[model samples]
Target: MTPASLTDLKAPAKLNLFLHVTGRRADGYHLLQSVFVPIDWCDTLHLHLRTDGQITRHDLTATLPPEDLCLKAARLLQQHSGTSLGADVHIDKQVPWGAGLGGGSSDAATVLKGLNTLWGLHWPTERLAELAVQLGADVPFFIHGRPAWVEGVGEQITPIELPQALFDTPVAVLKPPVAIPTPAIFGSENLRRDEKPAIVADFLAAPKQFGCNNLEEPAKAYSQEVVQALEWMQARFGNSRMTGSGSAVFAWVDTLSHQRQPFTPADVGVSDLTQTGPWVGRMCRLIRQA
Candidate 1:
């Protein structure tokens, strides 16, 4: 007997510890390599089963686009599974959009996972992930619910364990009001497309100070806010990097110096930064698993 409702399903956000662009495909898709880890900041979802075969979504927090990924995911699963059961999905969005935080993809993945159980599909994670990739590159990562080494335009996912120093580390993620369009960043002539390919061993050797985000250079050109956010983080943490592509940048709260005292949001001047502009800041921990 499957439950009619599943409430409080969480859709977590992810950070690209490191994102590299190795090459471009014939179809103009850029090849990428990155270590993606889930964070504690998340969106909450509530799902209720329906017998009338009508899928609906209600936004509880932030307003989503009319045809957001969550609705698409539910329709995709319902169609693929040939299930007459439908769902009324209510999303309590917390993760900020256009921050390159994978919020939409995470919500879509959660919808698929939650509906799979509610509808009694009993499909394996692999099956769910297969559908995930069709929706977006980042959706599969959330479906797997683990820290992963992602490559090849975000389809290839190899789960990896993080070192203790990186795991559960406090991070300050700051996002400006502007949303940098991903296509604009990718289409920019200045975007780097030929970074040398890296391996898991290379990242493992220095997870904290790994390879840089190839997309950041192009992203900065599109938005001065992006530049400001990066500068703000770097000033406080001594190092800051953009995650994925756009408007959000993050830094580990504590520095690498073993003798240095640990820092928190107050020590890093989060309040001052927020006061200066329409910046959203969160003190989050890097989770080992989603």
Candidate 2:
């Protein structure tokens, strides 16, 4: 008989308010500075703990590979903690893959956090975050569980609190029927590897225009879909920018009302999400940091 019941958890998506590649490490990893915020678009995770020491996945989408990040997270935690327990992971993926929305990294972070409790490890989040970085550049941010100022190849995180009005600022997110390969974007000859580092105070002073994404030119060169998405948002929402590397763009909505839910289509100038054919449109808000 199974000793534990199944648990359902959320793995939320994130948006990069601004991403700047300041330089490259001697080892070739790009150094970055950015503000990362969590959005309402999330993937659901169902986990069942097992004493049998066999990690498995019941994938709802065939698009995910057998060696996806979430499974890797579970195994990594199991090995480190020296826990004899394993997990059966079921994923209901909603965040579009390869869109620079940090879906896979978030999934991995959720798995690591979840397993710590389910396995009775009670490890501190700081320790978990240290482990998470090995999974991906974005994984530690999710484990930090806050909107953050990220630097140092995404290993350094500083949590920042935003005014509630910023949270009230509505956002519209759109993904074209395409994906951007992060490695290709990073490796492009056109990529900018030298931008002056930004100060948090300066960013807070003019939240919208602190740093430009160094990856946009290279990303747009490869994906016309990214160009189309940005153009569409700029036409409607007045100002638009690609979230991370490319393929998904977000625009600020001028209209603001108190919204009980994270997503409200009316807040984003969209009357309905279902009508946005071939484009995945979602209304989202910046979650309060942490």
lDDT leader: 1
How does each model score on TM-score? 0.93, 0.91
The CA lDDT of each predicted structure is 0.88, 0.82
Which digits, one per residue and each the tens of the lDDT, describe model 2 over residues 109-134? 99898888888889999999989988
Off by over 4 Å in 1: 60-63, 255-277
Give residue 115's error in model 1 in angstroms: 0.1
* Candidate 1 structure lDDT: 0.88
User: Which residue pairs collide, candidate 2?
Assistant: none
How well does candidate 2 score on lDDT at residue 113? 86
